[model samples]
Target: MTDTLALAGRLLLAALMFAGTAQKLASPTEAQALLALASLPPWLIWPAALFTAIAGIGLALGLATRPLAILAAAYCVVTSTFHVLMDDPWQMTIAFKNWVIAGGYLLLAAHGPGRFALRRD
Candidate 1:
């Protein structure tokens, strides 16, 4: 039961990241603009989106669980911090969600991805 719950969480987080990936790809120009607002390079939009997509897949499949989870969590923290710095009221919710998602990843990291993980170590 615990393993099943953990798997469910992982898949849910993956789905969320996939949605973000799609959004990024759908509007790279807008994403680039936002990245610039955060003092980041516009060229990173594609690579950043790809990172999320790949990490999302790995998280769902339980492959490279620990490191991927950490990456996802770090991504969340960085993005959320940017959003907070930007102080966009409209995007504050997104920042909040990112932190919440990061918490889930942190928990997954601590829990060892449960029994359903493809890579136990």
Candidate 2:
């Protein structure tokens, strides 16, 4: 049961990351605009999107789960901070959601990916 729950959680989180990656890819202009607003270089969009997509895949497959989860959690923090800094009510929701995802990622990191995962550590 615990393994099942962990698997379920991992799948859901992967789905979330994949969705975000798709959104970014589907609208690179918009994503680039957001990056510009964040004072980041536009060139970062490609690498960021690629990392996100690959990380989502990695998470789903339970490959390098610990470090990947940590990186995902750190990404959540980075994005959450960006939204929080925006100071808009609408952006606040995204920030909140990122923090929640970060919590989940952190928990998964500490707990391992369970027996059903591809990688044990």
Largest TM-score belongs to which candidate?
Answer: 2
Model 2 clash tally?
0
Error of 1 at 74 (Å): 0.4
Q: How do the residues 1-121 of candidate 1 rate in per-residue lDDT, one tens digit apiece? A: 9999989998988887898899898978877877888788898888889998998899888998888888899999888865674457768877898899899998888886778888875
When summed lDDT is taken over every stretch of 10 residues in candidate 1, the lowest stretch is 81-90
Candidate 1: list runs displaced more than 4 Å. Answer: 85-87
36, model 1: CA deviation in Å? Answer: 1.4
Q: How close is candidate 1 to the true structure, as a TM-score?
A: 0.90
- Per-model TM against the reference: 0.90, 0.93
Best by lDDT: 2
Candidate 1 lDDT score relative to the true structure: 0.85
| Candidate 2 wrongly placed segments (more than 4 Å) | 85-87
| Reference-based TM-score, model 2 | 0.93
